[model samples]
Target: MIKHELAKLVEIAAREAQSKDLIPPTALPEVSVERPQNPEHGDYASTMALKLARAARMNPMVIASAIVSSFPPIPGVEDITVVAPGFINFRLTDNWLREQVPVILGAGASYGSLDIGKGQRVQIEFVSANPTGPLHVGNGRGAMLGNALANILAAAGYSVEKEYYVNDAGSQIEVFSNSLHARYLQALGKDVAFPESGYGGQYMIEVGQELATEYGEKYLDQPSQLGAIGLERMLDMIRVDLANLGVVFDSWFRESSIYKEGKYQAIMDLLKEKGYVAEREGALWFTSTSLGDDKDNVLVRTTGVPTYFAADAAYHYDKLAERGFDRAINIWGADHLGHVSRLKAALTGMGIDHQRLNVIIMQLVTLKRGAEAVRLSKRTGDIITLREVLEEVGADACRFFFLSRSADSQMDFDLELAKQQSNENPVYYVQYAHARIASILDLAKDRDIDFSDGDVSLLATEAELELIRQMILLPEVIEMSAHNLEPHHLPHYAQELAAAFHSFYTVCRVVSEDIPMTKARLKLVQATKIGLARTLALMGMTVPESM
Candidate 1:
C-alpha cells in the first residue's frame, strides 16, 4: 500500500509538471516503486523521471528537481531526494513505522488477506501419484506446491478446492495389479516371472504377502481381482503419506469415475461432433494441430483402449464443463511437460478456454545428506519415499524445503541442514523467531507491564524500523504469489522477516531494564509474532510457541 501511495505521488508530480509546461500533456506512465537493495538509498525508489525525460525534452535531473519541488506533503514520508539518473528515493517516518504495530496487532491472522480473486472457483489438483506405491520425494514437491498455492489463493479471496486426480483406470494400475499378482503367487510358494514394466518396490511384495495372508490361494486364478484389491491398499498408503505431510484433498477425482459416470464418453462424443476428433487406422485421434500443436494426438489406440491423454483431457473437461470450476490447475512433474500443450489444445477444441486449465510442470528434486546424493530410500528400494524424508528431517522441514524453491527449477534438499537446530536451517530459523517472540511476550505479561497504551513512538532504531517494514510486506507477498500462482515467495519472505526480527532482537531488547521501552518493544515483538505465524500458516507449517 505504501508503494501504491508513492506511485500516486509520482503521478501528481508528473501532472504538476504538465500544468507548468515542464513536460508534454500526454498520459503518464504507470509508476513502479521498488525498494532499493542498498539501505542507504531509502525505503522506496522510482525511476519515472528517466522514463519521462525523452518525451519531455528536458534533462531527467531537471525534471526530477521540478517534480520534487511541486510534490505535496504526505503523512508517512519522512524525506524525499533525487539522485543520479533522476531516481526519487523515499524514507518513511519513524512514527509511521511505529504506528504499524497496533495495526498489525489488530489485524492478527487476517492481516495479509486480499480481494484479488473475488471468490472465483478454483481447483488445484496435485500429488496425483498413481496407486502403485508410496509417494516419492518428487511427488512431495508437487504436494507442497499445490497445498500452499491453495492456501495462498484462499487468502487472496478465491474459493479454492484441493483435488487429487487418481489415475485408477490406466496401464499403470494394470501393471501394479500384475506386480501384486506376481508377488501373491510368489508368497504362495509358486514361481512366477516378474513383469519388466511392473513396480519392483518392496512395498509391492508386502502388498502381495498381505493378499496371500488375507485370501491364501483363492485369488491365484482371479488375479485381476487381486490387482484391484492391491490398488485400493496402495491408495490407502498414499493417502496416509499425504495426510502425514499436512495435505488433505477436498476431492479425490478418480480417472475411472469419469468413465463410470459417463462424463468421459460424453466429452469424447462432444469432441467428435465438433470435428476435433478423427478416426484413423481404427484409432480415435484428436486433431491437435487444429489448435497449433506440433502433431495430432491419439485419443484411443487401435486396440480400442483410451490413452492416458484421453483420461486427462476428459478430467479437465469435467472440471471445466461438468463440474464448472472457473479455473483448473494441475501440478505435474517436469517429465510431463510435453503433455501440457496437447491437453490445452484439447480443452480449446472442447469450446473451453485453454487459459482456464493451468498445468504447472514441477522440476525434479534430488535429495542430499551431508553433500552426498541420497538416491536410495532407507527402505529396500531405490526410490526415496516422502514419508521417509519427512521422518528424517520433519514434516515442517520437509514442507518448508520443498516450498523454498520454484516449481520450474530443480532443487536439492539437504537432509543434514534441515535437521539442524542452528540458524543454518531456514525452517528452524523462522520457527525460532516465533518462539523467541512468544517468550518475550510472555515475559512482558509476567512482569505486570501494561502494554495496551504503550508509546509506539519509542521504536526509533534502524533495526526496529526495518523489522516493521518487513512485517507490513506480508500482504504484498500474498498478492504477488496469488497473481503469479507461485508460493515459493512465502518461504523466502519468511526467512527475510525472521532475519529482520533476529537483528531487532539483538539490538533492541524487548524485556529490558527500562520499563517504558520494554512495553513499546513488547508491542513490536507481538506484531512480529503475528507476522511470523501468518507466514508459517500460509505455507501450512506449524509455528511452535517454543523451540
Candidate 2:
C-alpha cells in the first residue's frame, strides 16, 4: 500500500514535467519505490528524478526539487526530502506504523491475504515423478516448492488446483514391472536374470513379495499381459507412498488416459491444422524453429512412437483449453531445463499464449550427513528415498530445509543440522519464538490481566517499534512471494520477524511491575504471536503451543 502511494506520486510528477515540455510526453522514465539499505535514507526512496534528469538534460538536484514540489500532501508521509544525485527520500509518520498493530490483530490469520488473482482458475502441476519407485530426496524439493506456491496463490485469491502428472504409460513402468517379476521368480526358486536396465532397489523386492502373497504365483506363469497387471499394482503402491509423505494431488493425470481418451490425437490434429507439423525423413517433425526454437523437433519418430515432447505438448494443451485454466505452471527439475524453450515454442505454434505457460526449473539437491556426502543415483541402484530423509530428519525439518533457499540455487541438505534441536536450526528458532509468546499469553491469563485497556503509545522502545514494523510488512512479503513465484522468501521473512520479537522480549518485559507498561507489552506479545503463527501456517507447519 505504501508503494502504491509512492508510485501515484511519481506518476503525478511525471505528468507535471510533460505538461511543462521539460521531457517528451512519451519518454516517461521508469519509477520504482524501494527501502534503502541504510535507514538514514528514510523509509522509502525513489530514483525517478535522476532517471528523468538524464533524459531532460537538467541538473539532478533541480529535477528532484521539481518532483518533490509537484507531490501533494499525504497523510502518512511526514516529509519528502531530496538528497544527493536526485534521490527523493520519504520519512513515514510513526503513528501510521503504530496504527497497523490493531489492524493486524483484528485481521489475524487473514492479514496477509490479498485479492491479486481475483479468483481466476489456475492449475499447478508438480513432482509428477513416475510412480515406478519411492519419491527420493531429489523429487522432494519440487514437491515442497510446488505445494508452497499453490498455497500462496490460493491465499492470494486464486482458484488453485495442485496436480500430479503420472507417467503410467512409459518404458519406465515396464522396467519396474519386470523388476518385480524377476524378484517373484527368485522367490519361486526359478533361475531368472534381472534385466540390465531394470530397477534393483530393495523396495522392488517388497513389491514382488506383496504380489506373490496376493496371487500366489498364479500370474507368474501367465503371458506378458500379467506384466501389465503387475505394473498397475506397482503404480498404486507408489501413490500410497506419496500420500504418506503428505503430498496429495487434486488430480492424478495418467499419461495412458491422455492417449486413450483421444486427447493426444486431438492435439496433433490441432498442430496439423495450424500448419506447424511437417513430414520429414519418415518422421513427423514440428517446425519449432519458426517459432524461435533452436531447431525443429521430432514429434513422432520413424517407429510411430511419439516422443516425450509430444506427450508434454498434448498435456499442456489439455490443461489450457479443455480445463479452461487461466494459467498453467509446471514444476520441473534442473535436468529438464533444455525442455523449456522447446515447450514454449510448441505452445506458440499451437496458437496458445506463451505467457500462460510458466516453467520453474528447480536446481539439484545434495543430501549429506555431517561432512560426508550421500550418493543418490537411481541409475546405479544407490539412492536415498524421500521416506528415508523424512524418517531421519522429520517432515517439518525436511520441508523447512528444502524451502530455506531459492529454488534456482543448489541446496545442501545437511542431516546433522536438521536433526539438531538447538537454536542453530532456523525452524527451531522460529518455533521457539512462538512457544515463548504462548508462554507469555498463558501467564497473562493466569494473572487476570486485561490487555484491552493497554496504552499502545507506551511502546516506544526501538526494538518494539522494529517488531511492529516487521508485523506490518507481512502483506508486502506475501505479495512479493506470490508475484515472483518464490516461497523461499517466507521462511527468510519469518526468521527476521522472530529475531525482532526475540530482541524485544529480551529487553522489554511483558509482565513488568507497572501495570500500564505490562498491559501494553502484552498487546505487543499478542501481535507477535499472531504474526509468527501466520507465517508458520503458510509453510504448512504447526506452531506447537508448548514447543
Candidate 3:
C-alpha cells in the first residue's frame, strides 16, 4: 500500500508540474515506485522524471526538481530527495516505521489484506488432470500455484473461487473403461485381453478387483456401467490425494455436464452463427486462423463425436459468460501449451474477451533424492503420486517446494532436502523463525511480563527497524503477487522476512532486566509472528509452533 501511496505522490507531482507549464503536457506513463535494494538509497524510489524526460524534452534532473518543488509535504515522509539521473526517493521516519508494530498486531491474521481487486469475481480452475489415475507429482505444482494464487487474490480483495474441472467424459475415459472391464473379467476368472492403451498402473488393477468384489456378474457385461463406477473410484482417490496435499476445490465441475445440459450444442450453434464454425472434410472445424491462430481446429470429428476442444470451449463459456466470473484463470500442464492460443480464439469467436481467460502453463517437475532422480512410485510402479510426496515431506514442505519457483519454470524437487529438519531447507528455515518467536513469547508469558502497555516509540535498534520494514511490506507483496499472477513471490518474501527476524533476535534480548525495552521488543516479535504466519498461510503451508 505504501508503494501505491508513493506512486500517487509521483502522479500528483507530475500533474502539478504539467499544469504550471514546468514540463510538456504529455500523458503520464504508469508510475512505478519500487523499494531500493540498498537501504542507503531510500525506503522507496521512483523514476517517473526519468521516464518523462524524453517526452517532455527536458533534462531528467531538472524535471525531477520541478516535480519535487510541486510535491506537497506528507506526514511520516521524513524527506523527499531528487537523486542523479532523476530518481525520486522517499524515506519514512523511523518513528513512523516503529509505530506500525501495534497496527500489525491489531490487524492480526488480516494484516496484509488489500482492496486491489475491488470485489471482482475471479474463478481459478486448476489440477483438472484427467480422471483416469492418481495425481502425479507434476500435478502438485499446478495445484500449489493455483491454490496460492487464489489465497493471495482473495487477500487482495477479489471474490475468488477455486475449482477443478473434471475430464470424466472423453477418449481417456473410454480407454480406462475398457481397461477396467478387462481387469474385472480377469478378476472373475474369465480370460480377456487387456486394451493395448489401457492404464497400466497397479492402482487400476486394485480398483478393478474391488469392483469385482462389490458386484459379481451384475456389471460383468456392462462395460459402460463398470467404467462409470471405476471413474468414480478414480475421482475419489484423486480427491483424497489432493486433500492430503491441502488442496480442496470450491467446486468439481464435470465435463459431461456440458453436453448433458445442452451447453455444448448451444455453443456450437452460436459459433456457427458467428461464422467462426465451418464444415470441411466431413468434420466441423473452428476457424481459429481468422482470429490469429496458426490453423483452424477441429470441433467435431468425422465420426460425429465432439472433440475435447469443443468441450473446453463450452466449459470456459459457462465459466466466463454464463456463470458470471469477471475472469477465469486455468492452470495447466506444459503439454497443453499448444492449446492456449486456439482456446483464446474460440472464446473470441463466442463474443467473449479472450483476455479474460488466463491460462498458466506449468512446466514439469523432476523429483530427486539428493543426486538420484526419483521417477517410480513404490506402490503404483508409475510416476510418483502427490500422496506419496505429501506422506514423505508433509504438506507444508510439499507446498513450499512446489511454489518456490514460478509456474513457467521447470523445477527439481529435492526429497532429501525437503525432509531435512534444519535451516538448509527453506521451509524449515522460515517455520523455525515462527517457532522461535513462539518460544520467546512463551518465555515472556512465564516471566509474568505484560507487553500490553508496550510503547513502540522505544524500538530503535537497526535489526528491530529492519524487521518492521519487512513486516510492513506484506500488503504490498499481496497486491503485487495478485496483480502479476505470480504466487512464487510469497514464498520468497517469507524467507526474506524470516531472515530479518532472525537477525533481530540475534542482537536484541527480549524479557531482559530492562522491563520497558523487554515489552517493546516482545511487541515487535509478536508482530513478526503475525506477518510470518500470514505469509505461510497464504502459500497453504502450515506454521509450526515448535520445530
Model 1 C-alpha lDDT per residue in residues 239-341, reported as the tens digit of each score: 8998887888998888988889987798899999999999989999999998999999999999999999998888888899888899988898888899999
| lDDT-better candidate, 2 vs 3 | 3
TM-scores of the candidates are 0.94, 0.93, 0.95
Worst 10 residues of 2 by lDDT: 222-231
Global lDDT of each candidate: 0.87, 0.83, 0.90
What lDDT tens digits, residue by residue, belong to model 3 across residues 1-547?
Answer: 6777879988999999999999889989999899999898889999999999999889999999999998999777878999998999999999889989999999998999988899999999999988888887888888889999999999999999999999889888888888889889888889999887677788778888898988988887889889999889888988988877778999999999999999999999999999998899999999999999999999999999999999999999999999999999999888899999999999999999999989988997888889999774323346667887888877776777788899878888777877774235588889999999999999998999999999889999899999999999999889889999999999999999999999998899987999999999999999999999999999988788998
User: How high a TM-score does candidate 1 get?
Assistant: 0.94
TM-score of 2: 0.93
Rank the models by lDDT, top first.
3, 1, 2
> lDDT at 458 for candidate 2?
82
Superposed on all Cα atoms, the candidates' RMSDs to the truth, in angstroms, are 2.4, 2.5, 2.3
User: Which portions of model 1 miss their true places by more than 4 Å?
Assistant: 368-381, 413-423
Candidate 1: clashing pairs of residues? none
